[model samples]
Target chain A: MKKVSIKDVAKEAGVSLTTVSQVLNDKRDRFTTDTIEKVLAAKQKLGYLPNKNAQQLRGSKTKLIGVLLPNLANPFFSTMMQSMDANKESDVDLFFLTAPEEDIEAGIMHLVERGMDGLIIAQMIKNPERLNNYLTTHRIPYVVLDQSDDHGFTDIVRTHETGGGELAARHLIELGHKQLTIVQPAHLTSNMNLRMEGFKHYCQSHNVATPKVIESTLSKAGGYAAVDDIIASHSTAVFATNDEMAIGIIRGLADKGWQVPQDVSIVGFDDIDIAQYMTPALTTVAQPIETIGEVALQLIMDKLDSTLTHRDQQSIVLPSELIVRATTARANLDNS
Target chain B: MKKVSIKDVAKEAGVSLTTVSQVLNDKRDRFTTDTIEKVLAAKQKLGYLPNKNAQQLRGSKTKLIGVLLPNLANPFFSTMMQSMDANKESDVDLFFLTAPEEDIEAGIMHLVERGMDGLIIAQMIKNPERLNNYLTTHRIPYVVLDQSDDHGFTDIVRTHETGGGELAARHLIELGHKQLTIVQPAHLTSNMNLRMEGFKHYCQSHNVATPKVIESTLSKAGGYAAVDDIIASHSTAVFATNDEMAIGIIRGLADKGWQVPQDVSIVGFDDIDIAQYMTPALTTVAQPIETIGEVALQLIMDKLDSTLTHRDQQSIVLPSELIVRATTARANLDNS
Candidate 1:
């Protein structure tokens, strides 16, 4: 099959190159309505595919948005990406960049070099100085989602992470679990720190003793390690910052023949898809993942349209609810 | 914050517009190597960004490969995408398209419209006629992975799916299980069909009775639903086509007070990351996910280089290994 070109499209439409170019780029002000209609008819007749790359180079919006996610395998971020991909069909297409925390710079540069019009970045790097420099220097339109803090740029979307922490603590306290421990990732961030702070504050306000806070990896192995720490401390309840770690704690406990909610109540954050379906139907805080994606995309669109800017920095804190599943219950007197 | 153009780059490089264009498009064969170097140096010095879209229009290659995966949240596929992204770093970048079986055409057209130079598709669709049509019509360079039956389109990379199925069945049979069941997705594809065939074939050859087979979704919910069917049939052993579904099945069985291996043995495929961390450390067949990703990307590279064509329909099936974990055990005659 012969490849169709701008000349073929113009010839079929009975229009000049400039007129067809204007119509293809939607520069309708430069072309008459009749010319636009003729070009459309010819485009359909010849099945002419417009050169998208050329149009993008000419400063025509590609309607393609790039999202740089941390890990697509992680259900939390993957679910968010899925929602954005499904919901942003009317005006924009989405491309994704997946980077581990260690490869943040490479991921950022990948999208930047691709000539993406807008970006939605959800990564937690140890330092945002490079990212900040890049964002500030380029002034590319962007929205940051679920980051620990502002890198002094763009609109931000966040959950009420601290609220979720408080709810987890309060739930354990209400269940008559006094001795508590917070299991967290080894590398602390403002995000994890805030949750820990909220949990501590809740316990203090309720006249309960400050719970022991143990730092571990946010992975299953980390949860397994937390088990030994819990056993050593003889804590009645363990609060994991994320559902993965929380479930890991459950698995670790089961391996040790320590029953969940009976010997030790476990609470986790980020009610991922598998949380509810876990054997104990994990007791955790549900983050509004889909809503977060929708809101973040909207914020990016607004920024691209010049409706929002860095000054706006719209930090949205969606409510987090504690869902009591089989993981948490009244403290067992046997262990106490 | 004005946008920079090729003319600006040429002026900075002290070269003619045509020379700059040639250098930018890597048409350096027409010019002296020294002249090409000078233009490139000037481009970097001036931070001159090439208009990728415009260059893509004039060039035969987009330097963009599209990867159409089934689900981003599935660890198996997500990890594959991650590794592919890592390996495809020398000038070729990736665009991602994800669609369900029903949305295959939309996905194909989406990638086509974006001018993808080639594609690496993991089409888990039941009926691939639409998928076959789009790839054929466009003569799109492609490499299909994980799906069964090469649609006679070359550049295919598949794991030993049937062999994996056979291994799962033999594993159960060796454990003295006579009655078994296999749970697969509701929408059956060649992938599932082949797996079922492998299982049935092994059962027949070994004089083991063919067990019950239930079709369910590839999700945790589907696994949950298939449990009642397994329970009703009183199968001593079950095989889940994928690890996620198997995890779901285990969860469902535990919910029904059925102890794994003691009363029934469960096995799953696609030893995903979470497989080792499952409560019973899922006994399953492990596909070489990283190798599949690398091979698929290499195949796409082959297609882009015109070293392979659709008529070749070369299929590469990597072997799978059975990893025995805590999930499967010798059938307990005491239950009988």
Candidate 2:
């Protein structure tokens, strides 16, 4: 029941204690491949885990990064988390925390208290200035992702929200649909608001009547509950802010005896995994989720390694593409 | 920039340091409600966060729990995590780690090394015996959730896998579907194998021909890829082990010019949030994810509090139910 120590690994590998420590701490560049392999094998054989706290006390890197996300039940966020987890370096460990709006501050504090070398914040922060100040004061390297507002003091990675919205609107408008409706959550984040703005801008510029807007929660249930309103609006085409809502709307339409792309066409945002698997493969604005994850992680790592300084404040805006699928079609102008 | 200390809170609240410590550590039963409120308000005003490591050094609870899930992309697991996170006590913080099959051991070590008071593991552990020994030796309280195999030494909470499979089989049989198929992953876990066994058992008992089995990865893409094989099997009814695959199967069938419930009836397991939102409102076996998460957290808390000893080894199995939705219907024997 005795705890295995670096000494045991050193003895087992017939190496010095310094060699064992160096290998375990990821300072193996100076060591030959055979020696490094031997140390790792010895450590594995002895089942030795370098305690993060102990390592911190010894002034070595914990090699741990913390990520704060809005929701995991939503496939978009979960898939992003999965991609980051998959792409992170093997020696670096990630701790994930899901924080609804009210919990963002507390969640950030929890990760900070854990002494993470860096952080990735994907949720909306109520006070970006205050958060930047806090993180800077604590000397913690961090990056912001998916938040539409300029973080002012941190590197930001996000998709072109406005372009995404315009793409959805243009597709539906091009289908000869004069009556259009957009579904979104009652409480709008900056990113969601930008999408709405872009949609409105596109419609106004095209000299088409402004689309009717329906407010609902940002979830499947929200879209389901908005079905009655959608029907009453008499819109021939609908643009849902996210694929989850679109899926719910599609089901709701079917339940009410309305057919997709025949009675109504639906365009959704965020081409999450299940979007394509829906009955009439949803036409959506495809955000490069995998690329975003990679960029965000790399940004954080650069900061952690002192390659990207705090003042750099890099902003990378990735493009969103419109994916044409079965759900969208020519409007039934004869019925109109 | 000075760190907030207990003394600062004590001065702000006009209470002694001992009172502040006791209140913050959940030992406030002896204090009046007024005193507890004042201490909490003072702590909030000063933004004082107790250093967990410092408290641990003083022999106080760290109030941290670690959860290991197989995959966050799976709605079933993600929803369970969300439930547990929502239901945990305010003072308790949960750290989440997603570990695929190969990373389970390393994930456990990482959490344990961080000195978490308790652990909830929802993923499959290859060497439960070794894990049990290691945890016991370290005096860490832990519980296994959703793992089908019995651990000789830890508490377990899981759904009735066999009963779930039986429910699926019974529904299809009652619908008069003679050609049945059960789609599962290529590599079966003990729990998945149990589901298949119960499905076959029900078919045998009913004197129906042995149902055909199709192997695919446990994902939407996997199900979509297996569509040709499923069609070749000529199954009048299909039972997918999870909702993700069932969704893909439905989409694939649509692509192949087949109609659900008219040409084939499909039932899925783990009625995830999107199940009811599917075009046909997928008929699925529902696992009470919220209940399971609650029970699992409660068990881990009980152990941490010393109310449930390691020797107790409680095995709580919850039931699964079949929800009949639009995707299932009576077989059209004439088409055959």
Q: Where does the lowest 10-residue lDDT sum fall in candidate 2 chain B?
A: B53-62
Alpha-carbon error at A188 in model 2, in Å? 1.3
lDDT of 2 by residue, A1-336 (tens): 134667888999999999998888889888999999999998877767665565554555556688888878888988888889889886677777777788788888878776566889888889888888777756677888885357568788989999999998898888898888999988788888888889888999998789999999888988888899999988899999889898888888898998998999999989998888888889999999888988999988888774333445689999999999989999997545
Instruction: Give the poorly placed runs of model 1, Cα more than 4 Å off.
Output: A1-48, A58-61, A100-106, A125-139, A306-313, A332-336, B1-49, B56-62, B124-139, B306-314, B332-336
Model 1 chain B worst lDDT window (10 residues)? B305-314
Report chain B TM per candidate: 0.82, 0.84
Candidate 1 local lDDT, residue A198: 88
What's the TM-score of each model vs. the native? 0.83, 0.85
lDDT of 2 at A141: 76
Cα lDDT of all candidates, in order?
0.79, 0.84
> What fraction of correct interface contacts does each candidate retain?
0.31, 0.41
Q: Measured by TM-score, how close is model 1 to the native structure? A: 0.83
Report the lDDT tens digits of candidate 2 across residue range B1-336: 234668889999999999999999899899999999999999887767775555554555547788888888889888988899888886677877787788788888778887567899988889988888777655677888775367657789988999999999999999998889988998888777888888899999999889998999999988888899988888899999889999989988889998998999999998998898888889999999989999999988888775433446689989999999989999987655
